[model samples]
Target: MQRHSLSVSELTEPDVVRRALDALCREVDGEAAVAKTALRKRSAFSEVLGAAVGKGYFAENPLARVKWQAPGVSEEVDPACVPNPTQVACLLTAVGRQRGRGPHLEAFFGCMYYAAMRPAEVIHLQISQCHLPKSGWGMFNLSGGVVTAGKEWTDDGAVHEVDSLKR
Candidate 1:
């Protein structure tokens, strides 16, 4: 295996850090994948750098010195990609008809459309966290979630066990 050594002092310059990140972006797969991976890498690197600076390893975080400019994102939603009311109705009807199947899927859609939830947030919901009454007009306490961690068949080693919603 090849070992790479990067000194903190070398990454202190804005230009140096920018160049390193640019190189990383080029090495990534596609444009979308590159952007996503680069952003995550940049965030993780910044966090580590911040901790190192606080521990007196460096006077300041080098990553903080650089001003990153993200590429322009399309603000307009694609018409073809956006589902119509009819399509949505069909999906909801199908989901409602899926008896004996996982109720999580149907409930997830309801939470998303009616309760305004993100798909990731819905997937993490537990039965214990919900409080839907018999009246079906009450709120649910979405606290935590369980995610698939490989093929373990258990709720062990899942990433990001959050205690609160992003809001």
Candidate 2:
């Protein structure tokens, strides 16, 4: 069998680095895939590049030395998506009216909108964690959340995987 792999010289080339950055900015699978590739993706690629430097494969990270303009992206949230207090109240009332899971999901949505909780955090919330005071503000701990990474990725062969809160 024949094997093909990129050599260290080919990997650190200017064209290869530019191609990767271009891919990050370009749409994939007919959808605009977002990436702050430097910060997000756990900086895995950067770490790899650093390893290359340590191994004397390169003098420096080629991507850092080069200057390129990424596509303009708005970081602000659109005002149209936000609901007013009155609208939120109306929505809550309507949610309570629906049958079965609606009543349960209303509180879930409240945690998302009011507390700005992630869905995973809401799902793993335990009643014991809540300190519901008689009058004033109550409190709860958000230690972690469960993620569904599918059976293939989990040790127990179950879909749900418990993980620490995101940074």
Candidate 3:
């Protein structure tokens, strides 16, 4: 609004929204914004514009006609960075060798590696949730996990909050 000297009413045009998106693509660091950041910003803009239309501030959402495309993003993991069985065994052995908290952490790390459980899930795991047999495969009935959001964000003002698994 400040850059174009336009109010919310004037922003109901497709061209104006496109130009605003173009400006958003350029970052303060003189580099193009990442695809994820641009996508999230575009979603936020679309949501606000949609609300404005619902409130009769505009006849329609200008962003609906905008054709701005964010840059491509890759979500692939590098296999070389992942540890193999032998390396993981060595790391676990080292952890178990430590005196104080090491023994406790060794089992935690084992759960993360063997069951593919996240740290928060392992921290919140209960014995009843695990179905281990004398000499066979074991099962884990995962119910919830711990989230370490700041105390201010939680209802009880605790640093960690128990929440169901994310989608």
Candidate 4:
């Protein structure tokens, strides 16, 4: 009775692979999920299959041979969604008008808009990094940032993860 479940050969079979792909397609259909989100899941799975191929466990990644079609990903940026400089300034001022921490948050949002810093990068920015000048220009020395990567992937089981600036 215990020997029936072991069938590693079936993993590479075309029919079995197709059936699994079909099931995955059906399961993730609808529910407000985007095509990119679903494709990312497949890509993550492909990495594991790639490792199996490297270890000589298989001829190649099963995913590489399988004919699975992912939905089209749009790379274009919509100009209509982008706010003008004046619009951004006004929005920042409006946030400052709010009670309590709103005024403090305006500068935080400003750095994201003007300096092009990510939310995580802005959060970790310290006063020591600032090169604030009285006149012309100033700069910041950004070394690293923190982001949310979910608790399961982190060593401390915390949702936030620290990462160096990319690019």
- TM-scores for all candidates: the values are 0.51, 0.65, 0.69, 0.56
Q: Give one digit per residue, the lDDT tens place, for model 4 in 74-125.
A: 5677889989899999999999999998987998998898888998998888
TM-score of 3: 0.69
Over 5-44, each residue of candidate 3 has an lDDT whose tens digit, in order, gives 8888768677888877877776888688777688788888
Q: Rate the local accuracy (lDDT) of all candidates.
A: 0.69, 0.76, 0.86, 0.78
The prediction achieving the highest TM-score against the true structure is 3
Q: Model 3 residue 24 lDDT?
A: 70
**Which of the predicted structures, 1 or 4, would earn the higher TM-score when compared with the native?**
4
Global lDDT of model 2: 0.76
Number of the predicted model whose lDDT against the real structure is largest = 3
For model 3, the stretches where C-alpha displacement exceeds 4 angstroms are 1-40, 51-57, 63-74
> What is the C-alpha lDDT profile of model 1 across 1-167, one tens digit per residue?
22576676778778888877666555445444345666777777778889988999889888766877644334567889967778876787788788776365666787787777777678777667677788857676776544444545435554544444665
Model 4 / residue 132 / CA error / Å: 2.4
Residue 104 C-alpha lDDT in model 3: 89
What is candidate 1's local distance difference test score?
Answer: 0.69
